[model samples]
Target: MKRRHFIAAAIAAASLSGAYPALAETDQVRVGYIADFWGASATAVATEQGLWEKHGLDADTKVFTNGPLQIQALGTNSLDFGYIGPGALWLPASDKARVVAISSVGNSDRILAREGVTSLADLKGKKVAVPEGTSGDMLLGLALEAAGMSRDDLEIVTADPATVVSAFASGQVDGAAIWYPFVDVIRKANPGIVELAKNADFPQNQFPAAFVTNPATVTDRPELVGKFIAVMKEAGDWRHANPAETIKITADFLGVDAAVLEQEATMGTSFTAEDLAAKSKDGTINSWLDGMAAIYVKQGKLEKALPAADYYTADLFVK
Candidate 1:
């Protein structure tokens, strides 16, 4: 099945059932993540392989269209644990949510331009599609600024992640700033697409997708949070050990092409126990969260930049 078909069926099922069927033997935890984002595959992997069951959790998963929506649900206690892109870091910095784990870090966000657009400056006055409050949106701003241009220089058409790919492919927009596997899809379909910039282009910025929960969840259910983190690590390590099988599993679960997933399979950070211990002990992951918070501060979305320790805790992972 294609991703769109799967999304439609999932939505219909969710509407009719109101929730995933829960097992009576395990504790229920509501999990959320941006749809199609490979960084959030840990949850999907856990669910697919019954890692949640192994860890004594019956996780009910929800697919969000973007990071901010997931953050909103987290704020309302609708999502117990979920993934948030760098753009939504302000929510956690402002106490709307709390970061518990660093899922992946790399240059997954890209500004893809159609043929004849050789530079970021070429995008001026051209329609560019991108979803607001996403890592793609943040990367777009950085790319524009690097070219000494502003959003006013181009026509910014707000579109969802899935919509951007279709619009870009049909020539509805001249350019699109989006993340993989959409970027991969667009490039594969349209050979003329030029990568204007990616998160990696700005070496100063670290693009990390974080696993987060509301502050209340952290305070009230510490053990549950710990178990969730443990399962995430288990899933992550499994992906590291089984790259080809991981691609097949993710393709089956997400309904994306296995080929596309294979090309970007290494995008998700797979940390071993030693890697986690070393990074957590040295506060490397916390610094990445703080860096994202700083971007929110500069954008005026946050009143003040909080220390990563203020909005994030590695205690659950380190314990």
Candidate 2:
């Protein structure tokens, strides 16, 4: 499918002229998400099942290559609503956007080592490739700390996800910290590769994926935002009930092998609207954002630590 940065004028013209009778009463929302196995699943499910229209939204979905770029577009008002993983949570913390809901929570990041490196300490003094500002980097930091080591202990090569994969594949780095399906790709290339640690192994790392929007978008279009969250919740319910069908849809949407996704170890946890409402009231969502902010502060990416209330709220989710 062709991805667009802006909604086409023709679409607006058609909606005004009633060319699309089915969409005449619906609110148009420009949705953006990372193009990965899990990132766009809720959007894809809603699209395929006509849930967006049913919920009074005309979703113009856009695919992004990563969380940072997606959040950048969101910050500049190119996207009205979108997904942002832990990697880009710092952007929202800086007041670029607001996280509205928890999209998923699980182990989406991994630290994979070459055959001979069997433990976290084994990677000490070795070369490690990682995307500098990603959930993978968060996992690497946490894992290293758990092992009583730090970035200085390893020759950390900062690279994008694709480059990290390439470096690991060519044996340019002893280990790589990345997310799937790239992790699966590396394992396919070298079956003996070992997993040093994953976000799942750490009880503290919930790896909460977020659904976000510009603060103004939420303030101006409150009901629209509520409908969007409802659609995602409904889609998440369907995915939980129909794992096989969900896998097929996700594979086709991402152009990934169905078999690989089937074997994915860190399939995220889905929540209901009521579940989110309870979590929100209890400050669970805010606490998650606070944790993300702490990671940024530790990395020195953020100064004068911001509270989760500054950048996140459960009002939309509650509504």
32-145 in candidate 2: lDDT tens per residue? 876565677777777887888877898888876567777778768788888877877887888878888887786768899989777988888889988777788888888887
Candidate 1: C-alpha RMSD to true structure equals 5.7
| Native-referenced Cα lDDT, model 2 | 0.75
Q: Write the per-residue lDDT of candidate 1 for residues 18-124, one digit (tens) a residue.
A: 11232334678988866553654676677787888877798888777777888888777788888887777777877888888777676678898988889988888
Model 2 stretches with alpha carbons more than 4 Å out: 3-24
Candidate 2 lDDT at 302 equals 86
Candidate No. with top TM-score: 1
Q: After superposition, how far is residue 32 of candidate 1 from its true place, in Å?
A: 1.3
Q: What is the lDDT of residue 90 in candidate 2?
A: 85
Candidate 2 lDDT trough over 10 residues, lowest sum: 5-14
TM-score of each: 0.88, 0.86
Q: Evaluate model 1: give its TM-score.
A: 0.88
